[model samples]
Target: MSLAARAVLVHRTTEYEELLARHGTHGQAAFFLAARGRSVEEVRERHERTSRALAEVTAAVPLKWRRAQVERADLDRFLFGPEDVVVVVGQDGLVANAAKYLTGQPVVGFDVDPGRNTGVLVRHRPADAHRLLPSVTGVRTAVDDLTMAEAVTDDGQRLLALNEVYVGAPGHQTARYTLQAPSGPAERQASSGVLVGTGTGATGWLRSLWHHHSSPLPLPAPTTPHLAWSVREAWPSPDSGTGHVAGLLAADETLRLVVESDRLVAFGDGMESDALELTWGQSVRVGVAEGALRLVG
Candidate 1:
């Protein structure tokens, strides 16, 4: 017996009409989730428009509407059977936020910005273990419309680190914060915010705020004594070398910063973090998280 193929179609706006037109079939239900908050009337209208276009190809196509923050357990129920595909649609920020709920499944990402036109998808089948996923045809044409790609995870971690989570003191403007890494303790600049980045976020705003170059240039305490004393470069390098500089700060997708006195604010990847407070002389751990996300072309 042949498999009754099931595909989950996810997109943000009406622009994906062309891609949906290509892969969506009659029996498969297209799930529409919007990143932005829209009124019931507006959402219903959008669904109706897409439904009409889908019906032209095949009748009996079910269209469902739900709040964008679809839970992981619910998705497990929705994709109970095998051969089901999950597609996530949004700009880079929205896509990164949605990834948290996806956990360990193959995720197809669709973004509209050409600069953000990238996707991470994973294939886990043993037979096709090493083969690459086929690149989305006409991707350039849809560069402004939709850029679809996939992300894979071996240990069920999201691959895209678009920002850093920061934790800092409350109320006090420009508080001195203690940064605790595995090795030792260091005093970071006196500021309302302090940020840490993943390897991927080295090129973001953290570099600019510190006046450090993106490439492998070693960071020294700036000649200005005030900035140098507060924002010191603990890591030492023999000379400038590509990809050999210390980890970045201020602009990481997964930033965790500690504020002075006793307040902790942690947020990353454009998502909100829980408020935490730690007393003085207390230790806060900081480091990299090891995991792999699947990448789809």
Candidate 2:
């Protein structure tokens, strides 16, 4: 018999909240959306759905366990404990955002609205939490150890990516860097950017890049131990030789990049809000992260 655990509900800001923030008032936001055939009431209903889903998950938790709620914006500052079991009541992107920050705690992805949400990470509904809690709390349970990517700068700064890592100049401009992989000659290259993608992210930006060419590379599973790297729009010039533009990275392998530009940025999972700045002569090592996201199905 196992004891109870802390259940942290992870949620994102509502559309209405965002609209109000952008338009400066709910009335103004409603008028803006009304012009596009949307009503403020519709946004309010979606917000209520998320709130109701949170309540449902809360009720599912056993009384002996500790319960808390957290917004996605506050996730970076939140301290997660070893025994914590996270229940995310939002879309898959919320889960992706949280994955980069988690140590190894099991995350229960419960979709707030199944009809409208294509939540690949949120496999279960809020009502399913009643039966799923045991899987996280019980001794014998199935947990998917989802692989994650990491970027380590030469200066010792590190960033984790749940989906893919974009290393390039700000504003998606041209990037100049040296590409180095295991058992290969270092090549200088000029390109828009380099994207390091995991199996889970293959269906996202990587998929588009994969289709950019006639020959498509095989994508790995979400829990696969490997990753893929692709350089977007590699330009060959006298100063830049492009040989190693795309390749697969083994579980133990890493892709090392030496920045040649005046400034470079590394961000993960399509979130421009979080990133690392790389300067001239600096290098960053991109590879599999030491930790994984324990996803509860």
Candidate 3:
């Protein structure tokens, strides 16, 4: 909590902003939404609320502290100092989006429109910033170090995600690969993809996958130092088997995969644009990341 520490405010472009960008004008954007039976006024109100919330949070920062702003798209290019305190101003997914690019820096999440986004990560409001900022800087508040997932390839490419990491084909074509569980025999499988998720992700895409597939493994809690993995739609054929479909990976263990298809992809937290590509015979290892998200309320 040094006085020289910087505060990095993180945010994402809103729907209204996207509409304006796409339509080229407010009137056109309104007309576009009107055609879809959606009201532009509502979108504008939410955008204004987000703007006010961001302004309030910015004002709440200590006057002496150095501050900077970064959009979600620029996070990969933004440099975060060791003593930086990250302030995420958006939905829970935005927190995940920022977490991958961060190290051990503490994060404060603020929800702009709570009614529309009842997220688990964004648990605070702009009004709480004044009181919370001091606690975060002083290290006097409770912080939850949430576990995260990692995917590393043999060629030195690595990716991290706050929720989960998906490894599969680039398109709808079946992903052909050999999956080796942490403590069992490897199995050649053909299916949609493979998903490795953390406890924070268990409530998201992982949950949906778990519901469809029954397994003896229990889902990890938010702070658990473990990961859950599952293969989507494993097709059992003469060359491929579905013996290893789901399992749990300990913090020290890893699930390995070897590509048998022409090309495969690995992405985290649903950001497919920023992903890792693998060629035939490439290998990847999925496990719990060494760094965890330090979230402060």
lDDT of 2 by residue, 175-213 (tens): 999999776899999999999999989888987877774
lDDT of 3 by residue, 1-297 (tens): 355878899999998999999999999999999999999999999999999999999999987779999999998899999989999999999999999998999999999989778668998999999988866867467899999999999999999999999999987469999999987788999999999999999998998889889676799998999999999999999999999888899999999999999999999998888999999999999999999999985
Q: Using Cα atoms with residue i matched to residue i, what is each candidate's TM-score against the true structure?
A: 0.44, 0.93, 0.97
Clashes per candidate, residues 3 or more apart or on different chains: 28, 0, 0
TM-score of 3: 0.97
Candidate 1, superposed: residue stretches over 4 Å from native? 1-86, 113-162, 170-173, 181-185, 210-259, 273-282
Residue-level lDDT of model 1, residues 1-297, one tens digit each, is 744333344344453443356547422223332323433344445556545433331221122211122332243233322333344433444444443334333444443333433322211221221121122221331211111111112222232233343444554344455443322344344544445443323234445634643345433221111100012233323421122113432211122234445543334444443233454544343333332222233
Q: Which candidate model has the greater lDDT, 1 or 2?
A: 2
Sum up the clashes in candidate 1. 28
lDDT of each: 0.34, 0.87, 0.92
Best by TM-score: 3
In candidate 3, how many Å is residue 267 off?
0.9
Better TM-score candidate (1, 3): 3
- Model 1, position 23, has a per-residue lDDT of 40
Candidate 1: C-alpha lDDT: 0.34
